[model samples]
Target: MSQPAAATNAFLVATQRALDYAGFAPPSPGATCVLVFDSTLWNTHIASVHGLLNAVEQARAMRFRFERDREPYAVGHAVWRIVLAACLNVPISAVPLVSTASGQPHLPGTRWVTSLSHSGSWVAIAVGEADCIGVDIERSPSQMNLSALMPRFCTPAECVQLSGLPTPLRETRLLALWTRKEALLKAFGTGLNEDPASMAAAENTIVAAPASCGRTAVCHVRDLDLPASLVGALAVPAGAMSHRLYWLDRCSNDVYGCNSAETSIRSN
Candidate 1:
């Protein structure tokens, strides 16, 4: 009989290809992590969740918050906590999963900050000691009404640039543009309420913050080299410094890079 799939194999073989594009490197003085989850692995991990969290507070929070939820979401929540613990070299239970008034997550007293994104069978989390970070990923939007959606979010220039693309390329580019805009909004704690058209940032456009905050906040964004089936973007404050990437399940280092189905596991 044929052997079963690798217990930790990614759902898409193409995802492996995407990682090559991600540009993984080792951690520096300020740590950064990219936690990728396999759909096939989540089911197995959930049953083993019995002792994942390590602190009384974290344990209590999981019991009331994460455990009560259903699969994938719950599993993803657990993974988020796990990523925090893994990066900090602390017990999963010792990591305090708290959010600010704007709903961005933080480690409370620690130097690490984070952003999460999930699409189809994949979940990705980027953590660093930068002022803030936001990451997003999505499946190719072949099913969406892109023509209808572009104007709502794409600035005129962005629209024209997208329009000039071949039919297939346009959709991916637009979705990627939207993904970067979403990442920036998440970084700024505005979510989608802020107009994406004005906020859009492309590979060439790093985007400027609003008139508020003296516009001193710098947004640095870039496209990830992911599979054609997916698109993604990473947004961090300009002074974030260097970053590294890792695979969560193996705790192994990862290097490179996609857009739209944004963070399925993140509540805010």
Candidate 2:
């Protein structure tokens, strides 16, 4: 298995190839793809800024992309812009991504559903035909204290179940559960602002939130086998069974490189 950095690179290459296979090309294959990293920059905020910028630059359209001219609220926005461009053929600077009153993002004049997530240095985004979808990626072997975070994030039963597992196993289990819930919350547009302790994941299923939250959206969870270093989950309102996966790579020459797809979306 590839280490985290290598695996992420592989995914980038894979995504770019998938886009090519899908018949979209913003630039030549041999050109460099841009992936900017600032050693002095903090990971938390810069992730979103770079993610959005990269997505726009890759698509060669910035109309819908977030304004890189200002500070970013979350790296997820950057990923969202790129995913939108790749899937919808729109520009990152496009004004369609205006937020709803509830903070849900919407594309103007369209019903496309979009979601974004970032873990460590990598981010993933998913877009679908008007179906509520949430995507999340978490860097595993997390530096956080599982014991303390588990109680705060896990359900009581989950805590009990985790306690019975070996330390290594327990950590993986806990992270998976956490990623699932985080995905759900992102779908809700609440993210970590919601109390994780109130959320629960059992049997790879997220228990429906209380009726007070308005309507219950259909939820589906899948473990994306990207790398052991990262845990990714997808939450979509129960909908269709088709999705295509792609890998993307950025070179320094203001051009993006595409790697052919190694996996295709299958019926769930």
Name the candidate that leads on TM-score.
1
Give lDDT tens digits, candidate 2, residues 1-268.
4455454444344434434544443322211111221111223234224443444343443343544422222433544455566555666556367666666666767656666655545656666674466666767887877776777887787777788888888888778777778767767666566777776655345346434346666565555555567777666554444343444444433334444322222323
Q: What is candidate 2's CA lDDT for residue 155?
A: 74
Candidate 2 to truth, TM: 0.65
Worst 10 residues of 2 by lDDT: 30-39
Candidate 2 stretches with Cα past 4 Å from truth are 1-18, 21-79, 89-91, 100-103, 203-207, 250-268
Give per-residue lDDT, candidate 2, residue 3. 54
Candidate 1 lands at a TM-score of 0.71
On lDDT, the leading prediction is 1
* Cα lDDT of model 1 by residue, 1-268, tens digit: 2223332232222234433444333245433445565443545444444344344424544554433343444455556665566567776668777766666666788777788776656666777766667888777864677767988999898888788788777877778887788778877766765778776586634566755423466677776656677777777766545444444332233322422222212111
Candidate 1 whole-model C-alpha lDDT, 0 to 1: 0.60
For model 1, the run of ten residues with the poorest summed lDDT: 259-268
Backbone N/Cα/C clashes per model: 21, 25
